[model samples]
Target: MLPDPIHILKTVYGYDAFRGRQAEIVRHVMAGNNAFVLMPTGGGKSLCYQIPALARPGMGLVVSPLIALMADQVAALRQAGVRAAALNSDLPGEERRALWRDIRGGTLDLLYVAPETLLKPDVVDRLATVPLSLIAIDEAHCLSQWGHDFRPSYRQLDALVARFPDTPRMALTATADTPTRAEILAHLNIAESDAFIADFDRPNIRYAIQEKDNPRAQLKRFLMDHEGESGIVYCLSKRRTEETAAWLCAQGYDALAYHGGMDKAAREANQARFQHGEAIIMVATIAFGMGIDKPDVRFVAHIDLPGSIEAYYQETGRAGRDGLPADALMLYGMEDIALRTRFIEESEAPDQRKRMERQKLDSLLGLTETAGCRRQALLSYFGDRCQPCGNCDTCAEPPHLFDGTIAAQKALSCIYRTGERFGQAYVVDVLVGAEDERIASFGHDRLSTYGIGKEHDKRTWRAILRQLIALRLVDVDLSGHGGLSIAEDGRDFLRDKATLMLRVPAAPRPARGKLAHRQASTALPEADRDLFQALREKRMEIARLQNVPPYVIFHDRTLIELAAARPASRADMAAVAGVGEAKLTRYGPAFLAVIAEHGKGLRA
Candidate 1:
């Protein structure tokens, strides 16, 4: 029903093929069927609409939320020789009018606008006259109530579908769980549209959650390990962002800070430095996550725990967008939980919204406390199954757990000896056989078990204390200024009737570069080696233009296989392992063209 899109691959977009279901979605959009795309953060969601916009007869309307993102996407599309323009609040009146004229003149392939602009009756009236082919909604998750970053203006998006009932529509977002997905479809009035859900697992990233104590030192060590690699350090406060960024800079790393507290101009400048790769580290708050298009982020570290798993996932998803190995680390403490809870409780949200926020908070706490595989716990929370990522901190240095029956008794005795009202420092002081003035004043020096654990070092004893708290053997008095008290379980341990396994912390290892690509095969013929690199570069360029991860455009494994087989036709392309009808139809010809070009060069 549509013209062959083969030329799009070579002439305009410069890609040899479509990855995953992109071509199918393109065809579906061109045929005027509504679509809902549930791709990951770095997946090629743009090509679905971009290719169709070029192939179809009329201009495609893309509705996006962020001004910076829309501007960046429009610039990239123009570089690829596609006619695109964005209309938003930031555009001057003359510039906006000119863009509208371009759209009406049939010169623009795609038009991007903010949802607020689309809500104006006058704007909708103008759009009604254009020969619109398709409507694309970016960040569709913002429409869902279950989503962490829900925007009220997004509720008006469904009206666009109503205005042009005959126009095909597609909605896409990176981080949406099943509930959020359902909400997106319901809100958009497209529950029955064809849905494309890509794989949620980002196997290239390793997940880590460490107990918070001296978090700044831990962060420094993490940065030192991954030095020179691009990373983001997330902090809960603006002050912390500035301080951390300054500290990293002092330590001889290229670092910058970004937060809402900074002036608009300064924030923009910092963001530019980061995007251009001039700054390898960005210490920021939640404001930095949504519109960042960087793909080579090697690590995402949380200096403080996020309030929820959704926030954590969305923030960490920024890393490894290139489908390369990345790391996600979280440092947590009792103060973090208290801070998060107080912040939530003081919010002005409705009761229902408050309840939802609490549920999300509980999920994050579970993530921090879980002793199981970090990746499994994370994916399971999002309603997916995943095995332990063998490269994570837990798998790399599996915790050394020892029977804590005796140690638990000693810890409980110390807490009891201190009248169960003192903090950890005092308890540790009493346990380590210290007879300082503070201990002597409270008669803790006279307790029978005061010197029982003196043989172990302070660090070892501290780990035991953490284990006690983690296992609920010791109750942290949340309302009592964080004092330590014996729990019911601690009483049982002291009676010598309970068994415990206390983990001894290991020395942190220097950060090492990720292992070489084990996902690719070594069996490629020597003749095709040059072709392989060419194909990968092409993939990378396409990824850069579309603002997606390289693997989502076309996986490295798929590219390697294509080089080996040298698929020379549509049918040949369809035979590749990951290639399907969507990809073959969208990218087959472009791929054939690349091989043809390379073949001629070799012959010459």
Candidate 2:
């Protein structure tokens, strides 16, 4: 008979209870059934598989995508006292042999392998000899071509499934839309009835998006709220990442640049620093953040737009994995939209796929342009819904909306009168009656729509045009000199004389004073703050000695519990959440001593 799952959760993993659907999923998997889990980041997806792996009779095999992710999970599991090991290219010769021996000897509880490594014939033959408890495919969204981060290697996982037909299989991902989920189910042969879809809301994260104006200044203002905290700043280009990192360093911030173009060793070193240190900011392109398991990233800032809502959701979901207050800020403008559209139009995909991409882009634009709650719109894209979350920028300070039909008419008429050949700058100039040579050269000065928009300034006129483009009333001609033209919707609106509402561009707010140090520390009382820092220092010291990320030793959440409860004995510490039998036995004394020291000092 198998051990009880709650026993493993309490003694091996140290969680008081299973979170939403985790208990159900665990029970189902342990019953020798397959499952497809769609949980958000930090939603305890790993625990859903890990607990069952320990409870079941034989070894559990996990298929992971990246080596770093596998290594991180292995380290954390071993620290928690579970017999976990990752079979990857990074292991030394003797270490690999020992792991294989343990696997063949039935001494390993769980093993993580990259898809490439697991697909090898020799490895498959070796694994066929051992009895397997279950198989889990992590980041299962990669199997769907409709997903934002599709991997062809994941499609080939069907071979492994065919080989291990008797093993109960589970597929897991944090990001997948309706179509992506359907495709994943079809590819994995997992029945729809077995899928467990959780709510996609990350209430701990505050969403905010701003129109790109003085991007550097805007980013600086955003950073003021997140001082002395670890975060990621994503840029669209490698040059931008390096430049932004250098600029941040000049401003006295410890920033590092990471991109695919950098030397492999250098990129790895930068990633290592960001993972191990608490205050470093990593300026990177999209190449950096897949499968990162860091739980304390305080913020994720985007200086440019992502291609789709899936990409945005996946990238922004990296922050606040510890379920603490975090921030997601994005600055986008008209150019970002045009560039993304050009990318879709220029891709080699089939027409149907291109149409799907266009629809996805439209959904993302709707998210950015929505006057309602950002979270609500974001969740709605994935076929989820919630009440208006008060944490996003739109909820905090709602934008003013006014009838913009007249303004849109003026802008579209100006484009039409000018032969729809000029870009936004030239078109705006013509609308606001600029005495420029280009307008005169194009004979636009004689047009009736030239001076009709003088009531609004150039900035307002440009804002109106951008809104029109976002509303699909105007189309950007990317094939020719980035010209402006009327879309079918624009023509229909003009013919119908339809009324429209547009948001008033918000003026930039003055940067507020620095807030509290860190969310973790601020949550504790003043008296316990010192103890929390001391505990963090101890965790870092131990982590450095062990050459693992500090979070692997003890998460900030665990430290907060220690500081708050001030457990005086090993038994007391063991009762704390996240303190499994292995951890309590390993580091309980050291932490208890720190608490004792703090207590004595307080008495004095």
Candidate 3:
């Protein structure tokens, strides 16, 4: 009959409302029902489980795979004054024992552990005896073999869950398609749990794909455009991460490199520096993103194409976590595609796995080349509909397009004439009528296809060649491997069996200034942003006391909008977006109380 923990959220967390399905998800779990949350990067996924853990009578068991993530989450929760502890191998044995004792004594609200630890025979036996209100899996996608960041250890989770079937369980991830989602359910044997799918659209990120010529120069230009803004640069190799980080530092930016190859001490040091805002850029391999909770990353760049769209989404999702404008830039070429294929071809994974990988790669390529709205394509892949976001490069500056049917025929004929042994540069030479020594050595000057397309400039021919490759009309011979070969589509074009329409590369636009100032100008004043955060902290406390997600009382953006507008009365508050009748009736007094208190102090 009591109002439950919703009042706690209003008083403690300073939130007057819930955003999206957070309240629904929280209730299902709090009532001892199982849940599976599919929220995007900045979708407030943590609170779906964290709030119930605090409000519930017993400690919440959180199974996290990474020590760094666990440490970060535990630190953040403690900072918010929640009683939390993590038991991991990184801690001293004595500390671990003490944590277990504390959990047993009901002194902790939440406890985080690695899945490996959860499966230990002794640990499982001990955990089974604890007063656990719920079991939560943080990165649940890792449990699926179909997932990009798959871990075999996560299979152990099923056994742990089997031991505590009566306890409520929730699995959460930022990226998972239908297949991976099903895999998580079946693997954990929780197929019937209530599923909450947050829309996958990242509205603030502008997606850009540039040809990777002079890649370092292109990267430098990108860094210059976003100087002093926070971002992550993902590299395919450790050496590249270090080199790029060093180069960024040389360019007078705060940059550091992180890879699994680094010593634990060094990696932690770099990660800590990045977390605390001491470094503006982190050049890292894939290991860097999993539990990264930094909310202000302005951009994410891939010097090469990632292996899958899911991986690409998860990586790029790390950017613009504050729901602000960010960029997702990829510099890709034929080599990146080949590299990814080689990985799939050489891996010991089963055929199904290989096929899945290929499908994901193809989806990523589709993203790079699609002429329609990029965000729409990305969201549609995850089963969400969206109008053009009007934010990405394709939306802001749509590419110029040309009919490339004739160009395709000419290029395909050149490749066939060259015996499919020549790469783009050599082919470009023949098309541009360049009778260089390399062309002379190959006798390409004598070919019927040579000099036929000399009417176009070298740059024009190069653009046509790049577009052809992007459209998959021409295949690069993986053996000789850099050389050009007509793909099935190109052969069809040569035989008049198919027609190709290719996009004309748009003229490059000058880089704009960082959007940080514009962002700050639109939000709270520099001085009041901290105060706004304090007020939200108070709102979160209120929400927690009431046993609801913070947003159920007041969304963070609404609070920020209020802070910017500085509304004093219910009428003023009602005018703000997302603050409706119910929220006004319930939360107007508490929010006004904080505003009045802050105003009084300022006037004094």
Which candidate number has the best lDDT? 2
Best prediction by TM-score? 2
Let me know the TM-score candidate 2 reaches against the reference structure: 0.97
In terms of lDDT, which candidate is stronger, 1 or 2?
2
Off by over 4 Å in 3: 1-3, 479-481, 513-518, 521-604
Task: Tell me the TM-score of model 1.
Answer: 0.78
Q: What is the C-alpha lDDT of each candidate?
A: 0.76, 0.90, 0.78
Ranking by TM-score: 2, 3, 1
Model 1 over residues 89-136: C-alpha lDDT tens digits?
Answer: 888889888988887899998999999988899999999999987889
Q: Which stretches of candidate 1 lie over 4 Å from their true place?
A: 5-7, 225-228, 350-355, 369-372, 404-424, 430-480, 484-502, 513-604
For all predicted structures, in order, the TM-scores are 0.78, 0.97, 0.86
- 404-456, model 3: which lDDT tens digit per residue? 77787888888888888788888888987886998888777888888888877
